[model samples]
Target: MRVGLYPGTFDPVTLGHIDIIERGLALVDRLVIGVAINRDKGPLFDLEERVAMIERECAAITARCGGEIVVHPFENLLIDCAREVGANVIVRGLRAVADFEYEFQMVGMNRALDASIETVFLMADARRQAIASKLVKEIARLGGDVSKFVPPMVKNELLKKFA
Candidate 1:
């Protein structure tokens, strides 16, 4: 079966992320959502909390998508995580030109690590393109409502954490 890896910090998975994952699920037999641990950009939610939040959000989509998606957390190199999961493809979401440039570089690096792994970019829904975890967190921390950007579980967690 063809497996694809979708790796990201997922500080808090957004609806844009869900849209890409849902759309990407159609292209591969199996998709593993890899929640990477990034030490450079400190996250508001810890890895465990971020993983749980992603799991809850992805569970519904996985069920609706016929259970071809799996959510997992990894604290290693993305290519290593992809290899571990037996993935031949890396799925990414493209929001803008800037994203494309950044992802293109990362894709090249990943390809250098594993020549067999290919990167696939899915454009984010126009409306959701502007929504990102970092922006959401910033807004929530300042007492702005982010109910529309993130899942309910994530929204609650953000509120609790920021409150």
Candidate 2:
């Protein structure tokens, strides 16, 4: 079976993320969404919260895609996480040229760390390309409506969090 790892901070799952998740599953038998704990960048949501949010979002997509979407929390090196999960590919989303430049470097580093693993980048859907977790959180925290960018569950959580 072809297993792919889609790792992200996922502070709060957004529509763009869902778009990537749905598309990523098409390239692999099973796509494991790894909610990585980035200690360097302080996140609004905790690890458990992020995992739960992703699980909620992925549950709906799982049935539609006819594939398994497992949410796992990891703190170790991404390559190690990929190896542990038996993933031969790392799925990533590119929203713009800036995202590509950053992801491109990371892909090179990942390849250097594990030559056997490959990185696949999927372009974000045109409408969702402008949505990002940082901007979503910022807008939500500042008492702005973010219903259009995130799922209802995440929107509610953001409201309650900022409320």
Q: Could you estimate the TM-score for every candidate?
A: 0.95, 0.98
**Using alpha carbons, what is the TM-score of model 2?**
0.98
lDDT of every predicted structure (CA atoms): 0.89, 0.94
lDDT at 88 for candidate 1?
93
Looking at candidate 1, the ten consecutive residues that score lowest on lDDT are: 63-72
Write one digit per residue (lDDT tens) for candidate 1, span 11-110.
8889999898898889999989998888898988889888888788777987787758787788888899999999999999999998998888998898
Once fitted onto the true fold, the runs of candidate 2 whose alpha carbons sit more than 4 angstroms away are none
Count clashing residue pairs per candidate: 0, 0
Best-performing candidate as measured by lDDT:
2
Candidate 1 overall lDDT versus native: 0.89
Worst ten-residue run, lDDT, model 2? 62-71
